[model samples]
Target: MQRPNVVLIMTDQQRWDTLGCYGNEVIQTPNLDWLASEGTVFDSAYSPSPSCIPARACLLTGMDPWNTGILGMGRGGERHMGIGFEHTLPGELAKAGYHTQGVGKMHFYPQRSLNGFHHTVLDESGREEDPRFTSDYKQWFERNKTGEYGMTDHGIGWNSWMARPYHAPEFLHPTNWTVNESLKFLKQRDPSKPFFLKTSFARPHSPYDALPYFFELYMQKNLPKAQVGEWAAMHDVPKDASSTDAWRGVRSDEDIRQARAGYYGSINHIDHQIGRLLSYLKGSGLMNNTVVIFTSDHGDMLGDHHLWRKTYAYEGSAHIPLIVKLPKSMGRTVERTDAPVLLQDIMPTVMEAVGLDIPQTVDGKSVIGAMKGRSAEARDFIHGEHSTCYSEEQEMQYVTDGRVKYIWFPRIGTEQLFDLSSDPYELTDLAQRPEHREQLAAWRQRLISVLEPRSAGMTDGDRLVSQAGKPFVKSPHYAERLARFPLPF
Candidate 1:
């Protein structure tokens, strides 16, 4: 059998519930929902790290973020750059004769760093910090639109409740440009070898600036109200908090409504753009030879629990929608699995799908068995973490097996446990309950195994630890390779 081409579609900060197939009743996502219906939808997919650079690092490298050194965004001078993984998914595929092209947010340092893709056209929205590389989308906007209007002219803060319709033509938006360039690569790619295309979208992350029609559609409709639990008071913002403050709680009910509407509007717009790529594939008769996968780097909270961004262990941050569609020639049908899988698994799964070798360096197990309708579980649980990005309190680690989740905040010595099967929204904290003490103890032991080896000192072999240990990061790729791509600022 000829190897299949691979198309991985990713969105930034998009929640798992934003697609129709994922039980999203309100969002307009016909095209994505169709893909889910045709493919195996892994219901418990999660990002190893619920942040941009780190989560993306796991996806590209198929290694844990602890080894990758992108523990968080690496912003604000404490760390200027991220670890450069030598054995990357695209690099491996490219080595194996697949022509790989990445479009949209490849959020690596030096911005121009190919990471692994043979070619990448970037639309890393609003990141001008990297003086080394000029954004292709920015230049295109200048070329076509005469740079008359910027994407952020509507005045919505990067992470705020401010909602507005896109001020310019829909074609000029970065979301469309991302797919536009990806389609261009598809159209021009060599036919002698199967290609790997990453059609990555940087929207729905924020500047929640949807196209006018999308905004109007959501603004006129009534969407689900934000979920606020009794335990969420800690995240509540004072009414006096700045409107543009990304970390402060959204104090107004009306403001949260606008944020949710804008977020949904962006998702719908992205879905519409995805339909364009699907249209092209089917029209060109190339759909028979390709496998399409869809996911996101992480998810937005959208006012849930009085929070707005990702990085928490909540479902909105950790859980991601994952769909994989095999070509009809492959004899696979629409199957769904609840086995927990991580973003890193995509690398091994794609390698397996195309009949390439799964490198031993890749820690993620292939979910091909799950995709093939095999009942065996892919993983018992998934472990993930994020460092303090914008907030000192955001540093945390989590482990979950889909039925339950445990989150530990290293900074505050806090623990939270949730029975996801019973409380999907995570309204109650089970960590303090006497009935769940044994269960919580079991999870903490699991966390000890997961973190103690990292030399984090957060846990001993048998219990949680307050302070201890030397750095255990032995990978030369972390600090050694990081020097090559110094922080651009």
Candidate 2:
């Protein structure tokens, strides 16, 4: 019984339904579909937080954002929370006698020097917006540099909607560079021992710059139209929102169609890259011994409900794709499991699959049993949180049980409840309905019970004090600053 090698491949802002195996006929994700067919695909998987940094922290630490105090972005939050830089998944794997390496966007500070990995390739020199890194992209056009083209600035959000041209060489895209680096690492691996490699692709997140071939593939396909609802019109979205959704202001039938075309094209591009990586793995003789897990940090709104990005608790943003390929002992060939899982579960699951002891402090439960075809009670409930990002807004939390979802907006004192079974789009709010009051109370208590234990030890001094007196941020500039400097680590 030798320990298995682990390869955790993650993409930024990918939706669960984007893959061909997930019932999406327009996007061709042959590699991901193959992984799903050869492994266990958890139909319901979610991120603990909808935002990038917080969700990533949870993934690497196997703890909730609140538990790790990584509620926001930047070094400030990580430092404030006193989360030692050494407590990540790779660090734990390294301690357990496994070689750990990472490539692409891990999204942590000190972007270089193994956050936990024994080796990291294609590391960005600084934040994407840093002037030194600007030359990496050609269409970053300084005048149009809304600050979203690179990782350094959070001013402009990156998404398919803001399809900027790339002037730099094709290799500058993080996904391209990450896969190239990962292949290089694979070539140098020691076959006698187990290894843990995290290959993160930073495309499909935004500035949707794909090679012309990818875009061309989808340009000829007929994509689905955007989903919009009345409630979406009430909130003030950012300017880049219009870039992704041509109908943001015009709402013409044709505009929605065009947006969908471009969005699907971006996803196709991601799938092609994934296909390339998987082919290399199989050709290199690592496919049989390696356990490959493919998933995403969070999801994109992609014009769902008129919202263009993540951070919202809507299914379009919170739900993600999760596929795990275990060795023969773990079973094989597309057994669809109805297990309720979270992104945080990935850390523990990988450790368990590799025969390592699960850390007691980690909150996620290993799904090894489920992967082995054993029946078990699915998770009782999945929780998610969204702190202010690019906005000085009140904090929000969500809890769901696959059928119903409850969202708590503390700042506006408004709560939203959605019957996911009936309304998958989350277009209607049932909070004020008298018949649903009891259900609301039950869900609220469930949320409180789950959240109370995590907040029990917090002191008044540790509260998110900076957000107490500020008005809810509505400006994109303020939102950009918030993205660069998030709060209450």
Candidate 3:
């Protein structure tokens, strides 16, 4: 059997419900919708850790964040520097006689470290502070764009929720560049062997730089209101008039609405680019042999719960779209599955698809069996956690099985339980309800079971014990961030 080629397309900070296939009544994601109609959609997929480096590290290493040894954003001091991964997707596939190419935002430390891809074209997006920082997209922008322009030359802050159209031409956007580069790779790749290509997007993240047409499309629609739980009221107040608040702040309803407009626009723009990639594949006859997978590293809050960014245990920050399209010859077709899965599963699933080894080090199970209509849950519950980004309260952990979620804040010893089956929006907290006490306790026991073995001092004998100073940076990785090594640039 000829091994199938692989095209793994991922988005940054994109939510689960933004696509037309995900029960989103308002948004129009025609390309992604078409992909979903033809592909196998993992309806309950999530990132184990809802942050960039940690989540992506899981996708790259096929291990949970704990085993991958990247518990926080891989930045800051020596120990906080780039990833120290044991294995990588491209690295493994390249060993299996596949030509691998990586394009766009890897978010890996030392910026340019091509972990496993045979070669790469990076678009790290004005991230000059990274150790080995050079952006292929920026260079292309300089060469092809009519005038000198900062990517964020528009009045929007890099992390702002402000909505605005891109200042440059649409082709100059990194999303288009990602597609263009992948197309170039398709034309130039080694034709003798199977290929594993990854095209990752850096947008819909922030600065809300959607193309004008896309921005206008969502701005004109009757958008859904942001979910504001009664529990979210305390942190919902705007701290300042400014749109960019690193920490929790009050944002106006208008501000959130406009932010949603930009976010949806960004999603539309990415979807269009995916269409371009798909068209190229179909035209080039690769469609018959290539398996296409679409997903995001993590999700954006998009003003959900008054929270604007990721690292939260909420569905807004954790839930993501997972669409996998097997080759036409596979004779297997399922529009969607309710099976709970994670981004880490991509590693072993792709390995399984290409007839490669599924390593023992991988914490994720391959979903190939389930994709082929085999009975497998993949996981009973996914363990997710992230260290503090801005406040001590941001230090949290969670476990969920699609219908229910248990959130624990170890520092303050706070807990939230949501029955997603009835309250999909998570508007009410059932933790304090007497009727749900046993269920709450059972969820807490699950939390204890997950935390006790980690040695992070978050638990003691089946009970959560708050530790002093809040070990925001998990160790070994924490110690590495404290140590020193020469940077790339």
The C-alpha lDDT values of all candidates are 0.81, 0.67, 0.81
Q: What C-alpha lDDT does candidate 3 achieve relative to the native structure?
A: 0.81
Q: Model 1 misses residue 2 by how many Å?
A: 3.2
Q: Decide which is better by lDDT, 2 or 3.
A: 3
Query: Ten residues in a row with the worst lDDT in model 2?
Result: 457-466
Please, what are the lDDT tens digits per residue for candidate 2 over residues 1-489? 557778899888887888887788878878788888889888778888877777887888887766656655432233222224435688888887778888777665434435578876644323443324422223223334444464433232443355433434455555666677787777787766678889887767765555566655565677666666556665445563455333133344454454455456656766677777789878876778888999898888766776666777788788899999887766554478766688889888888777777777688888777677665546878888776653333256789976889987655456789898788778788998999998988887777766555433211322222234544322132234335555322
- TM-score attained by model 3: 0.94
- Candidate 2 similarity to native, TM-score: 0.82
- Considering only N, C-alpha and C atoms within 3 Å, which residue pairs clash in candidate 1? none
Better of 1 and 2 by lDDT: 1
lDDT of 3 by residue, 1-489 (tens): 669999999999888988989999888789999989988888789988887778888899898877766665622112233544556788889888999999998876677677777888998876766655568888888889877676778878766777888898888888899999989999999999999999999887887888999888888999998898988876755553344644356677887788898999889888888899999889988888888999998888877777877888898989999999988787786677777889889999998887788888788988877787775645778788887665666678899888999998866778899999898778999999999999999888888897777776777766888743644546454345334333445
Q: Looking at model 3, how many pairs of residues clash?
A: 8
Give candidate 2 misplaced runs (Cα > 4 Å). 74-86, 123-160, 164-173, 236-259, 332-334, 373-375, 392-394, 455-489
Off by over 4 Å in 3: 74-84, 130-132, 240-243, 468-470, 477-489
Model 2 residue 9 CA deviation in Å: 0.5
Tell me the deviation in Å of residue 318 in model 2: 0.9
